[model samples]
Target: MVNKPVLPLSPIPKKWEKPLRGTVKINFDAAVSKTKTGFGVIARDSEGFVIGGGYGFKNEEMTGDWAKLYAFEESLKIARLLNITKVTFETDCAKHQ
Candidate 1:
């Protein structure tokens, strides 16, 4: 067997961004496994402080893409419930077709 050159590993640091003044940022994500789909949501203020957070589970199985879309919908519902008018929605899924 021939020896192969190893690549160096570098870590990239990620930071949470603050929303605009007087606005809240709502971030959401979803995960789909063999059995079910789960999602999480978080609301942050302009200072990057988390004001509210939520997690949900779906018993019915669905495709990963659908799950992501559903999670986004749920996040919006939560925001409405919270009476958050000015919000910046963030999601890992592609919003447009």
Candidate 2:
């Protein structure tokens, strides 16, 4: 008899967190498909109001890691444009880490 190995499970958050006062929270994500890669970033204030956001697509093929990195970089650019000094960046790509 052969025993099957159990795969590790990732925890899902039940609730979302808001940033501290006078601060902003940025969330970024990326998706890779056979045709193209899509990336986006959104910035929200402490009250959960969206301050700014941007998204783009790459027609060229790319690895998942590269796509995720591009999403993070875009988030930083958006944050800078908003003039937000204090920020908390979050991403849902557990596999990237």
Candidate 3:
């Protein structure tokens, strides 16, 4: 097997943060259930415009590693639509990692 060089990703430029003023944060969580899977997203500005952003699906396809990857990819796509760059991503499956 040939070894391939792995290049690290450069950090997103700070310029992306210019449009955002004050402090803002968003949280994402996912709960996997047999009958249904649920994920929630909450966005809040320092001023407190708490937004309820979440979705739930009742299907077995919404479980396991592939499901998890899909969830993150979808979230990333949504984030790209907005001009938000600074984000905190937390996952409870840290140990399994």
- Write candidate 2's Cα lDDT for 1-97 as tens digits: 9864443365665466998999899999999898799999989999999999999998967788888889999999998898889999998745732
lDDT of 1 by residue, 1-97 (tens): 9854432245355566888999999998888788889999999989888888799898878887888888889889888888999999987523323
Instruction: Tell me the deviation in Å of residue 65 in model 2.
Output: 1.3
Tally clashing residue pairs in candidate 1: 0
Provide the TM-score for each candidate, comma-separated. 0.77, 0.81, 0.47
Clashes of 3: 0
Candidate 2's C-alpha runs over 4 A off are 1-14
Give each model's clash number. Answer: 0, 0, 0
* Winner on TM-score (1 vs 3): 1
lDDT of 3: 0.51
Candidate 2 similarity to native, TM-score: 0.81
Error of 3 at 95 (Å): 7.7
lDDT of 3 by residue, 13-88 (tens): 3221211456445555566667666665555554557533455454654555555665565556555655556654
Model 1: lowest-lDDT 10 consecutive positions: 4-13
Local lDDT at 92 for model 2: 74
